[model samples]
Target: MTANAADKSLQAEVNALPWFHQIDFGNGVLSPGWIKKSKVERVSRTLFDPLNVTGKTVLDIGCWDGAYSVEATRRGARRVLATDHFAWSEQCWGDRRSFELTRQHLAPSIEVMDIDVPNLSTTTVGTHDIVLFLGVFYHLRHPFETLERVAAMATECLVLETHLMRLPFTTEPHMRFYPNDELHNDHTNWWSPNRACVEAMLRDVGFKRITMKHPDYRRRRGIFHAWR
Candidate 1:
């Protein structure tokens, strides 16, 4: 991995694809991505600082570009499995090349699967000590049913990051539905659940305890740490 290769061959490959997570290849080569390098680094801290993953197995669902998956390996996780489908498929704007390219440079030992949200099961993917369900909740058509499946795959904890719906006047469990691309400009964006709704869903899915925080100053995003 020389500077010349990073500047020429690797950089060209990175430039050819769409990237979700901005990543540093540690050789002065960086992926020009939608999620900037600084933001991803900040989110990484917000995600990992509250807990430890050293020597633990982690499963990352919707692991586009493998940012968190690679970070788990960097934090000394015993094993990591990064999975995705829409973000890697032809239907989406991105491709699997970004994730593969990042893993080739950053964390080669990490496993990967082209698994969709509905197909996740302990029998298929095996349960993990820590499961990362980041930025995938609202995109699903069946958030509650999917939570049950996701919960079944977490042996200890589930870290869920999602776009939140603010119903400031009420504490009731409620989710707002986006019939079109009204939430974001993307059609994949479907539902946004408020704090109470998400917490309640986590409880119904078998988590003994749940905590949520908004890393950003904006009230529309949240990260839920659920312990089983």
Candidate 2:
């Protein structure tokens, strides 16, 4: 087959996957998954899709279900490491069963590791071409410090996604909800951060070439693409 024909075939196969159908975004409607619908995926496809990843390394931090890791491997990453704190009991939409299901589905191309975030070290995870921090930062108490550690393990790029508070707001703008407080303790809950605070934190950690983009659909959240 010609290269165009091969490309079309691959695209068709990817589109036919179950994940390409729709995501169960919690409330219903079965919207398309972020990879199929969000700006982050579009941006990633534009920048990195052409690169050959047959022997490259990728690390996915807070890889809740290994979805991104699976995609990385499918795109030709030789090895993809998916790590998470595995404290799903503390998730805002807490569901341990769904996490396991995701793990099972991504078993072939991804390696899942359960580790404590603060204690992450080179001994635990070595360096990689890309390190993804999708939707993990706001959940941490020391977001900047954690990014520093993650940077040490990333040789090229770090892709991050998190909730950002609007500008002209103080830390006070961030509120604490006690909805799941009784179950997981106060520390294991959610945090909403302001964009300025997040940018300042990243700059202080020595991230360069920072590019921020709001998701096409979920304008409330943002994606930060940076290099060390």
Candidate 3:
């Protein structure tokens, strides 16, 4: 087949799926994903540094489209594991095609698992130096318990990003429950915890040092880097 034909075929396959992460395929052919958020620019530089993953084992929970999984591997991580079940399964607006394609096209050596958050443990997925728990906290039914499970497998650090429920003058940790799609018209979204709530919860879950930063306050998206 000609190069143009191969590109057309790849484009047809990419356009057919629901994509959450924008992945770059070579020859200037990029996946036409819905999310324009540059995980490399916005996420890698500010919230958490990908350069820090050099020679470390990394795990990315809810690794939609394997963006960070590929990034971690590119930054020289010893081993990279990506996991997801809800978005990859038939219950959501996404599938594993994007991740699989991205992995195949970019970082083929990274491992993947179709596992849920509650099932994460040292024994199940083994421990890692860095664990990324981004965009999955609010969607979970058991938030605190889920963090504890995530922490159990972290040997060095855990970086988490989630929707923050900002309540001014509230020093104590608190969470707002979303019943019947009160937040975004998505039934999967269950809770939005304030920044204080997330930091406190991370400390409670055995992370000795916790740092919180907000990429966009108006968007209510906060990032946390917790160290063991």
Candidate 4:
């Protein structure tokens, strides 16, 4: 079978799973099956669509359920590492089962690690050709520092997806910060960041090429790609 045909078959299998049809993002109740399938589809399209992934090493930070890791492996990544804080709560299993299932489904190519994000070092999870940091910045207290650390681990590309603050030209309400709190919590639904601030931060972290994507000009939300 052709490579494209194989990929389509894999994608179809993932989408056909029952969990993919039921995910409650508003309530933060993600079906691990759905999250894994959707992330595989999105990351595969975004990162692997233009470039060849064979023999490349990919790192997925804050990988909730090995979704991106699975897709990277399927796309020919030689090695893929999935890391997350795995901070479990009463409501969530912290994606433990999903990671294990993904590992069982795809062997050798993907490795799952439960580690604290702030303590990430070269000794723990080595550098990679591509790094994915998705839906994590808003929750971090030191977001710029986090980006710097993630950049240090990426040899080629970094894909970041987060909530952005509306700029002055945009017709969106300013987000209010909690007293003495630089981080967003369950109480705070969103912590929007201005484009200028994010650009400056990325520059400071040694990212040369940067591209931003948003649903609209209103700057309600966005994703960014930074290359070293």
lDDT of each: 0.90, 0.62, 0.85, 0.65
Candidate 2 vs. true structure, TM-score: 0.65
lDDT of 1 by residue, 68-130 (tens): 999899999999999999888888888998999888888999999998888889988999999
Residue-level lDDT of model 2, residues 1-228, one tens digit each, is: 996676555445434433422332222223233344354356456435534557789888876545566668768888888887644435433333444544454446677677768877667988888878877776677766787888778777777777665545364334233345542365554565655556666667777767777755556677777776
Residue 110 C-alpha lDDT in model 4: 81
Instruction: List the candidates ranked by TM-score, beginning with the highest.
Output: 1, 3, 4, 2
Deviating ranges (above 4 Å) for candidate 3: 37-40, 216-219
For this target, which candidate reaches the highest TM-score against the unseen true structure?
A: 1
Error of 3 at 24 (Å): 1.5
Ranking by lDDT: 1, 3, 4, 2
The residue-by-residue lDDT of candidate 4 on 148-206, one tens digit each, is 88889988878777777645785433443444444444632335466666666777788
Q: Where's the lowest-lDDT run of ten residues in candidate 4?
A: 20-29
Best by lDDT: 1
Lowest lDDT 10-mer window, candidate 2?
20-29
TM-score of each: 0.96, 0.65, 0.93, 0.72
What is candidate 3's lDDT per residue for 64-177, written digit by digit as tens?
A: 898878878888899999999999887887889889888987999999999988788888899999998889999999988888988888889999989989799979989999
Candidate 4 matches the true fold with a TM-score of 0.72
